[model samples]
Target chain A: MAATYELIYWPGAPGRGEHIRLALEEAGASYSDTARLDAQKCADIVWAQMSDNNLGDKNTSPPYAPPILKDGDLLISQTPNILMYLGQRLGLVPSTPEENDIYKINALVLTALDGLSNEVHDCHHPIAKELYYEEQKTEALRRSKEFIKTRLPKFLAYFEKVLKGEASGNGPWLYGGTFTYADLVLFQICLFQPQTDSQNLASSVYRKRDGVREKS
Target chain B: MAATYELIYWPGAPGRGEHIRLALEEAGASYSDTARLDAQKCADIVWAQMSDNNLGDKNTSPPYAPPILKDGDLLISQTPNILMYLGQRLGLVPSTPEENDIYKINALVLTALDGLSNEVHDCHHPIAKELYYEEQKTEALRRSKEFIKTRLPKFLAYFEKVLKGEASGNGPWLYGGTFTYADLVLFQICLFQPQTDSQNLASSVYRKRDGVREKS
Candidate 1:
């Protein structure tokens, strides 16, 4: 019997947890999105897991934040780490592990997360993650402007390079002509992108990617 | 005779590249720190590799930034991914390949980098990573204060939990009492921390962890 996975993350719009959820859905794996459950029934699950009472945590792997997963007794956290674990198990990555193509796929995953996901996150909360967006609006606006102008395009151009390469086989995929978990990661990241920048396909940096014109 | 690994990163005080360098040094592996060379002799190395000519990079893996490495024909980027590769080859990770402890180790590495290394980078550049510190001094100062008050202690307290746990073997080591690449990563991050907090280990979060007094 396949073990049912339980995913723990904040209940809200798709964040990093969306990357893991997309991989699981693509693989048709059994899983539970724990934080999405009814608030009355599962309110403490998040606080319990990220419990501030670190003094009592004797467990081998207590996660620092959410987007954590449990597979039987084993617990894992970190968006890329969780995706890598599921990638190896659910046929989302290349089967030939000995060749080390997995690490290459993982490099692509880290880039998308750092360049797109995390950067956009920081733009919204430039001063402090603990404080709300209202508390940091002035700094957030400046950071967001810089992100749209500089950082976003740098990453989009890099993805354009990957999309154009022979390794990606000339269309949508990010690596080696396969629909690896990296493709899922890129797909998830595109959802949160500033719509205005990403939509103007002909004028945007993504114009250089080969299949964009044909698809449009 | 062993093949010497080639590392490509900027010439400056230890940054993310130090994580990889420390791992290589600890494993006693042969490698070259490309940017550490004399100015004219290797001035173009960093620019050439992170070159803006994205369309021409048809290789299987073109790195987005430096601390990239060329291991024969393979080029791996991303700090944690590079560490994982070296950890596997140089015995910096646990030897068991099938058990998946490597991911557990990687989760620790990511937590330290995100919570410490990347946070500090943001403290210096809250508005724009490309802009000088003087251009963003007001915002940077505000962010740094929040970092000292909230983010740093949150991560340190988490590490304190890890150190107190049996998984860390009741001491300084991060996982299984074995010195893996993650240890090297933590050591590098500690260099950039605000000095006063970490030094007064007695009154700070480190007090909760078991072994600091014995060692100091």
Candidate 2:
């Protein structure tokens, strides 16, 4: 699809980029997912962007990894950072300089990325980011058990609590009465398939989302 | 130290909180470090805040972890989120809503926190955050080796390039000709001991900082 915003990411299970795509889709903003390219080509483009020679110029700082978002003269990286930029521009968040809600929403988003995404990622990778899952399976299994026992429920309960907050109103939203990128982020990552065996916890949160539309 | 801001974090080797301390010090913002309290009281307070009963209210979302910063009625957690909040209120970053520098600066700060802080942190606690360092010593050593070999040099090279960017203006600052929180952040985390064996890479970057004052 043609888009005014070009998202440069590996066209695979790029969950970090998927978080951005969720925000973009909700905003109905234009952005190509690079889905037209073959797998190898998508990987190549991701590597090429990280090449030192093409590292950003004076105004632009080079992005260390993928899921980069380019908007005209401005190029941004880092998932939360891109989300913040998009959140401000796309009405996924309020833009007024005096509002403190932007930071609150970003805080919840960062917590999700760390607990739900990064921690879960390390459970599989355990020892190394470059190593394959098979190489770390033993450690991965052990880590996964711990994750299910603690981290997963901890974060989900935290989000569940947020939805129950007085500001969250009747149900389902992560912040205030309106939907923001933080809500979209929780749905896209932690809620979808919900890497958990505690069906009770997952089902309870799922019911809350009945108040809001959710997409896989 | 009486200050307008109150930082609630465990008073120990709270390196994450130290990141905030660096920015506050550089900006000269007043915030008590909670050093006056005994260690037992310190640990109790940290756990108490995380208790679900105190998670947050209508306007506030409870923080999942510490290094939380409170500015009057506003409460923020997550290192980068806190940094972004402080960056705007203090002069660590440009406050103008129209300027993109805020995001650019934030992007760099997040990258540093991930690569330098989070990744390095995982090297020690590869299996679980709650696992003792001694328990994970073997994996920690293995992870540390990989970090020293690849991640360390890669991130430092990335920062060195940032310092070399034309906008960096032939000096040590991470962005533009100014010494914002980004520079202080680099100094506080990566440069303090710079968990790397590449003396040549480390020294080259250290020499550039001769143009700027560095603290331990």
Candidate 3:
């Protein structure tokens, strides 16, 4: 079957785009990644799509950032929002309306990405994204220490407790007694941590591939 | 009807909770503000709910942070996720699947809050959220300037263009020719801006309550 989805994100970096890629991978969904095709052209396309006078067909609303997913005529951005839509279409969520489970799973996905992903990004760019990492190293070190000591432990412990809850049915999944998009999201975030750190994660959840923890 | 919705957050500050409050107010929805009732008690409740062994009915998963909404058995956190769920329940979104309009509107809301509210909060705590503002004043000043110069203008202009797009129908509404949650979210974020800065926003969308611009 032909890929029905097109993802446009920064080239050579598994930053925000990793979360979406993991969801696609878990779903085994066919998709084209523009960044991996031609980095320069992908960057050009991303910039064009973000502009007020984008080069595409004029009616589509401009995407405000990269890591955009194009499905037929729809263009969606924001990591969690994209994941929410894809989780439904890809059967990565509970296929029932019981207990408002979609919202529950979505809330978990949002919290995981916010703390593990967004805050980590901020640690590297504490002063400004416009500034280089070297320029913000002092602030980055401080922020990172606080994040690991305080926020990281809290988030990890919360998810650990969640996994043990009845919602998971004592399974490794985060919800519905089955693997869902929330698991894929958490798995992807764990991949970003160092091997030792990921190994030390509360739930012993990180998977090993070929003697090295695989990214994405 | 009595307010069945319970909102828990830090007191004496608008912060992200204001976005939820604005959505409720705009929909004329009845909801309890626990933080506003007794700030200390509310803080205690929030902390308890966030703990690994939270003193709650054990089935519900712990919220990773505050600004949680408890409606019956469901407890949700993450400002945008909470707002997204409420937007649908309160009829604050375009009530249709046409054109993937809901996702489009939600993407805009996420972008607005991420750049404006999230980044703005980071400006004062560039080094660490645990640190005092005085400790990070120099870094905060630097980040704030970049935010004011680059991020603020970019976010404002993008939303202004979104308002003018075909989805908006050349009106203040952001999607499907109706006042939706996206508008309420944007309006609330604008309220957080300084009076002069909010007035100078690219779009003439912010309104005055009681014939005066109300600062959140």
Which candidate ranks first by lDDT, i.e. highest?
Answer: 2
Q: Model 2 segments beyond 4 Å from truth?
A: A94-98, A194-199, A202-204, A208-216, B94-98, B194-197, B202-204, B208-216
lDDT of each: 0.76, 0.77, 0.75
Candidate number achieving the greatest TM-score relative to the actual structure: 2
> Tens digit of lDDT per residue, candidate 2, span B61-94?
7788889888888888888889888887888764
DockQ of 1: 0.57
Residue lDDT tens for model 1, B107-195: 98999999989998989999989899999999999999999888887887787676666766565677776667777777667644444
- Residue-level lDDT of model 3, residues B53-142, one tens digit each, is 762334456677888998877888788888888988898887664756667778878888888788888888887777799988988998
The CAPRI category of model 3 is medium
- Per residue, candidate 1 scores C-alpha lDDT tens digits across A1-216 of 554999888775578888888888888899988657886455478788778664323345578888888898788889999999999899987665547687788888999899889988999999999999999999999999888888877788788766766666565666666668887777666644444745453232333233322422
Query: Candidate 2, TM-score vs. the true structure?
Result: 0.92
Q: In candidate 3, which residue pairs get closer than 3 Å at backbone N, Cα or C atoms, i.e. clash?
A: none
Give the range where candidate 2 chain B is weakest over 10 consecutive residues by summed lDDT.
B207-216
True contacts kept of each: 0.60, 0.58, 0.52
Tell me which of candidates 1 and 2 scores higher on TM-score: 2
